[model samples]
Target chain A: MSSPAQQSAGKPVAFVSAQALRARMHDAVNDPHLRQSFRGAMDFLMAKRAAQFPDQGELDSLRSLSESIRQYSLSKLPDLLEQLEANLTRNGVQVHWAETPEEANAIMLGIAQRHAARLIVKGKSMVSEEIEFNHAMEAAGVGALESDMGEYIVQLAGEKPSHIIMPAIHQTKQQIAKLFAEHIPGVDYTDNVDALIQIGRRVLREKFEVADIGLSGVNFAVAETGTLCLVENEGNGRMCTTVPKVHIAITGIEKVVEKLEHVAPLFSILTRSATGQAVSTYFNMISGPRRGEDKDGPEEVHLVLLDNGRSQAYADEQLRKTLQCIRCGACMNHCPVYTRIGGHAYGTTYPGPIGKIISPHMMGLEQTHLLPTASSLCGACGEVCPVKIPIPELLIRLRGEANSAPHANPAMVGQGAAYDPKISLLWKLWARLYARPATYRAFTWLATRFRALTPTQQSGWTAARTPLKPASRRLRDMVKDRR
Target chain B: MSSPSHGANTPRTYPSRPQAVYFYGTCLVDMFVPEAGMDAITLLEREGIRVIFPDNQTCCGQPAFTSGFPDEARRVVEAQLDLFPGNHPIVVPSGSCAGMIRWHWEKVCAGDPALKARAEAISARTYELAEFLLHVLGFNRKDEGPATTVTLHTSCSARREMGTHLVGRELLARLGNVTLAHHDHESECCGFGGTFSLKHPDVSTAMVSDKVASLKATGASQLVTADCGCMLNITQRAAREDQDAGRACASLPGEHLATFLLRRTGGSPCGDQK
Candidate 1:
């Protein structure tokens, strides 16, 4: 990934600071229209979440069960991949296992060449963004148009996604109107949200009809039945997978599940966690391409399982839970920091708590060291997590792991470790003095003798705020006096 | 003074409160902000509570735990457990240290079954100073602290793990002299994450800068906090800025909750709360 500075310019996310983000959110939250859209959506999902379990006990049980399922799936990933391939092949769908993005891109280009594909209508997929599939496909003389409304707006604006669910969340309707005018020529620009949605639908509907091939992302792939699942509200995923003669689905290997039963629990957790909705509008389960009396489906189906450092993640027990992520983007929503800066500032395909942990491992730790330290180690991510992955704990663990690793940014190791005791001992005497209350009291009395001599910002603590002066009498002395 | 309250009359709840609670007068209160300890004791006593000052109650092993010395942290936590025996809740004024004790006690005491039980018992009862004030002691502070406007910084450990942000707001509202205003990023850490300042000073300093910016945004004249670690951090930064500019900004440097209460009682919380 490029530097944060570069990505942020293209994205131009307004709320990069936690304070700024909170201020903007507070302002926008009170606006009637935005509140109806944002909070109404959140309330609907939160209600769905509450309805699923009825009580905290059921939620806890579900979290534990889902977590164990993910653990088991990750443990048997290698076996499951082989099983999924065989089952997919038996069902007449081609299965391609890609070790990296380069390999995945190569396979995609080969497939496109064999079929003489020209224009590809694509569904919105973080996995596709992860591999920069559009850039690769375009480089190979194929045009890729995003069919998701939020995604199309971002694509037209020439920027990466600012939010996982709401790709263009940072953009105001007015800014989008300008973007549509500048990019979608001869179109009358209207800042109305409904008008914008209609415009997006008109553009993608045409692209969907003429697309040589349909490209999509699988939300979950069942190993037992070789079925690929795609869940979305817009129905663009349906069009992307069925309207074309050849349908190609690309997803990470971790997206594979051993059985259909495993898919439901995850879906139950993901939909509510992602949108606070009980379930998405559409949950398409595709076994293979058009066969027998199928009314409207693709002629050929292909499933590409991209590794891209996923296999390496399974090797380390501390990092395996990362694969359990359902890509709900709930962590980003509640994250005080991410809400401020938005996703683009992280400069990774994945952003927020999960991004911070996975990005360093995938993109080489040195380049992404700053990512882990960006957090305040707040446990909000872990609390709202449907699967109950200890994200904050994992992020801290990653920091420890990063310390020992060899990386491109060697200078940062020293810069980051400035708080280590080897640097300074500002509280040395204070620490020793507080070892016993008697001594601590005596020291306080003596310090009180010179209470006026206290320096406001004595040492390293001076970097933050003005120090309050110490009290003249100790609490123990006050207790004794009361007695 | 060990209380006689440890007899069999009390039935044990899943979260059983100890007969005699030991107030771990953390380093900040024992020295810099001692009056905070007095306020805690008064609040606890008012609720039919018997308090014990564990003179041996040193630091919450935060310095050692945060410094990556698990063994040393264990030693400190072990000493703390010894100081306050039985199932008594260990309450302290500083949310940061209370969190370190409540959260890290198990991790430090892992493997030894006996130590684990003792640690878990303590962890269950370990409450940050104000959480006990609002939740356990239940003494509403609505009548304290003069009506001076102030911003509250939700220390990282306190707000994230202990969930004390609203509790602080609730108690601060009770104070007579204080009108609590929300900081722009009140929930963000003030950047004094234990040894974070020493180990990653550049990042720590940058974080502190943001924290300072957040505090400034509140436009309040004073910054009040439950964590002394944060108070120290904000104090240090404010002083540095004051020194650099050669002028005192409108903001009051750093004042702990105890000092606020003490000053309120003394009829001048804004300047000499302690």
Candidate 2:
């Protein structure tokens, strides 16, 4: 409240505090133009997803399959990771392990330094963004650029991806055209979508050709065949992984599956749930660097598996469900809060429903506790998750973790970060009052008797609503009167 | 295939309609929307099923349960566990409260063996009012009221967790005198997420405004909701919106689906209308 951070498109460029988050939400709620765009886009996406799942039975079955595959793979995640490392190494690919964002950045930087990499061309790799890979590489004097059209536009604007799948979804074509006219060299103002994409591609194609290193994200890392599968509608990902002399992929450790066959159900459901596509335009699989008799490919391949608090989530039974996400972004597309406030309001690498649950582990409850409570517990995210992540249930658990007293030897970092003694005492009193029938009845009786005196300024409820007053007669009294 | 999203599509066989059922008037209904509770009981009685109002039943412990105070929630829920001893079905008029008792009690009571058993038994027998009326009682009613177009709005819990979104429609299907108007995005929440309405008022207001406008755009003279919490939020917002637009407040009078059905069936409401 003291220092209002710069606002763009009705959201804070970054979240500073819990108060600022609400302030940002207030701005977002009142931004009619932004609200209309988000509303229309979310509606279009919800319809597309609904159309993809014409058969409820099919959706249920596929969701179940994807859920089991992820759960089964995560159950043996340690072994599968070791197996994956061994298999990838055997297939002439180098595998690196990173436990934190700093470690992940250092490892990637070391690889960049080893290759004497001056420029790195990137695809739509959220993990790279999560570790602030571009900033890290640039600080080390290695130029890193985005090849994904949406990501490129977001980068050019010096902003974070607003949504996961469609990074620039929050931006209007006019905004992009204006951004391009001001930033892109020799580019004129144009609101045409095709023309804009062509301009971005032309600029990025040069980067791909001259870059020393290419970076991409893995959709599914198959341990059985030691392959990294990438699902993309655009060919930019293929170019990033195959065009350069050295290809490097980064992803969370949870993306690994045990068998090649496990990828099918996940791939099909992810595409349909993500963009309403039967399959992505390109489903590129990279088993290793260019083979001995290969046609055209990178000479060396490296994979970085970043932990970054996933292990904390996997430590508990119920919390492990957070890792089942397939990065489909369907949950965000269906979330009511996301539709209203957009994504940058969260100020996390991931945004919306997934961010609410997962950000707590990555950033700790101290920073991300407010994210979980931002939802209405509407179950839209969980109801639409392609992999059955049980998002609502996980959000509830994260809330408990945030508010509960952290005992000795807590499982998560920054546990009980949001706990307040006053709030705890309040719930205690409420429980005591509600647990006893006599107390509750007497309370209701007094409340109804003094209904006229009930305050209209009932905290925040009366902000845009009429005050809720008790009825003259409680239901218990009404039943007795009828009798 | 068992999945969280498709929990609604899973078919559930109903228990045989029993002679007596325990009525769980949620705290919201008990204090604020008592008329809805009265109408629900009257409808059940008219079906020849004796309705037992458990005096000790205060709440399903949802507010505390969802607000990160599990110990407090469990204490409240454990007390309600003793109110219903036998296997006679427990009927709750609100889908959210019903969902908590039916689906979440076992999870909340996961620590204790005896508590878990009792929670499972209670869950197996609990039903939302509309779901019980249609599925168990095979409720059929003749609409003897005037022709009024009305739109039905349900809570997220009712639509997703309880899968009772269609139950209200089915019950209204039997009321020939009433015309049901469709609203845009009917399944979306009315932003009455109990404490969520209080915690984040601005976002909650925005969501409720959209809901009220959508229901109004249908040109329905009246609104019916399955949950009183949503009723509290939507009706108040509708009235406030009307007052803001320089019109008489409460023009689109909102009522519980139970009350709407009862009045349509010629059953006079027992409580005074506010």
Candidate 3:
């Protein structure tokens, strides 16, 4: 976690608070280069995902099944976690529990010190980002390197991942070429995508070979088989988990499923929705560390199950739907708000529709309250969601939660910023006026009669358009005249 | 009276058209665009159905509801509900207002059982103008107006909540002399999300601009939309942009679907009656 001071010192802005979101949004919209980057990338991703689900019937059924499966797993999450722990222990893997990010980091650092690990290679784990593992490791004098190409570029540039699935999605190849030229020991600048991949591969291969510990993120943790399923296209995931002396996998506790069969459909839609691949090149299911009979794998395996407020989401029935997210990035790709502002403006580990809903749970609504309001409630995120998370409904619910009265139970995170006494009183007065026929008629009469008095310099309305002027007469009065 | 029997996802069908329809002139139409409301009444009366204007009707409570004040929304919505208490289909001139009643009313009133029942009852009978014409009345008429090209802007709520975008397209297709030109990103929102527009001005401005650009790309002579909120946003932006570019704002302002349908059909019947 970058402290407030560190965040301010950093070149790229992170650590977003709800109050800062609007200003960030303003800057993001004004930057044409950033707009074009996100717009083109989102359009490409939307087109690709649309092609994969050509048949709407198939898509609907898959979504329904996925929703049911996730709901079922979440309903029995506590029991499933216990089963998973037992099974993993039986398979000779140490499973550690963490209630918060600090605890999770401390546990990982303790493991690192125990093994006297100097360097760790990581396979694209969002959970690691959530804990700010790289910073913690660096502070503890341990070298932590990102093996995924996107993560590596973002890390090298001293910036956080702007996007979820495609971390450096906001960067153009030219910008990346420049970054590589500036950072790499001896690399010629190149804009070719394949050449860039080769450069990343060459550097990460040596790191993987020399690294003492391997860190990874679990896509699905199967309780029945005690397996941690990882999906990736790059071969780095394999190298990081198998070649290193010790392997550590960190994941949110909500990622668990009851049975191995459940992984089939979720995996199918996860890749199809995220980047449009039918299936990823690699699907590594690690059940245990290397045994005497096993040839090429780590000597020991450890799993750090981080809660970090996931239990709070799981406790609420409606909010629990947020946990169904497979991190496919489909919602963000189809989201108009995210497309305009991109990921950096959100200033969270996760950005876009998923970030808005889930971050409130992880980081609390005080910091993320404005995220829900950022949307136009266009429903594109919900429409394209693979797991059928009702994002719009959740947003509305979050808004209501944010505006709840101070006396309300649950002691909500934001204390309802919209629920100002003055605003509430204003709405009450407006509702009262509209609720009665005589007051409603009298108000409209006054509004139409004093049309000229309507201000031309209204705050947001007249900024880009002409002032709103009331009509000469109301429809009811006109109807009476015609009669 | 028998209720319309439409399954969850199936296309709605009416067994027989109701003799009388209650016209809920949305607060926007009742205030800013009375012509659309009058045209709606004229069209319904011409179709041999009695149009009853509920005098006490004001707003649909969507503004309050969507702005995160369900209590305020309930009070306003409950007022309108009592005015249309019967089996008569409640036809709204704008899809946005109709969507408020159809999709969100019950949710808004979920805290109280009696109010929830009232909301569900009222929501069942509510229909957007185009939806009523396409589904209930099964309106199919030959266009008698001049040949013209028109593009349609489907409001976000109408498209997502009410599924009235299809009905609007079908209604437009029924006209003989009208060519319905489709824009590239017609499904995208115009960003008039009630309070959302005011709260996030820059984002709203950018979104409305994109929508206008799409409409201009269609090269249609006229633009028709169902929701007054969207019409207000698009027309205002169009006029502003045209002025900024130092061009004569010759483009016809966006028309509500009801007004467009009435004019294209043969003008309002009230004038003929007079």
Between candidates 2 and 3, the TM-score winner? 2
Per-residue CA lDDT of candidate 3, range A77-176, in tens? 9999999999999998999999988899999999999999988889999999988888887777787888988998888777889888999998889999
The interface RMSD value for candidate 3 stands at: 2.9
Candidate 3: tens digits of C-alpha lDDT, residues B15-79: 37999999999899888888778888888888898988889988999888877778888899888
Q: What is the TM-score of each candidate against the true structure?
A: 0.76, 0.97, 0.95
Q: How many angstroms is residue B113 displaced in model 1 relative to the true structure, after the best TM-score fit?
A: 6.8
How would you class the docking of model 1? incorrect
By TM-score, who's the top model here? Answer: 2
Best by lDDT: 2
Clashing pairs in 3: A402-A416
* Model 2 chain B poorest ten-residue lDDT run: B1-10
lDDT of 2 by residue, A1-483 (tens): 000111122332334654367778889999998899889998998898899999988888888888899999999999999999999999999999999989999988998899899889899999987887877777677877878888877876778898999999988999999988877778899999999988887887777888999999999999988999999978999999999999999999999999999999999999999988888999999989999799989999999999999999999998999999989999999988889988877778898899889888998888778778888899988888988888888888888888998778886788898899899999999999999999999999999999989998987799988888999899999999889
Error of 2 at A326 (Å): 0.4
Q: Report per-candidate TM-score of chain A alone.
A: 0.81, 0.96, 0.95
Clashing pairs in 2: none
Q: What is the lDDT of residue B80 in candidate 1?
A: 68
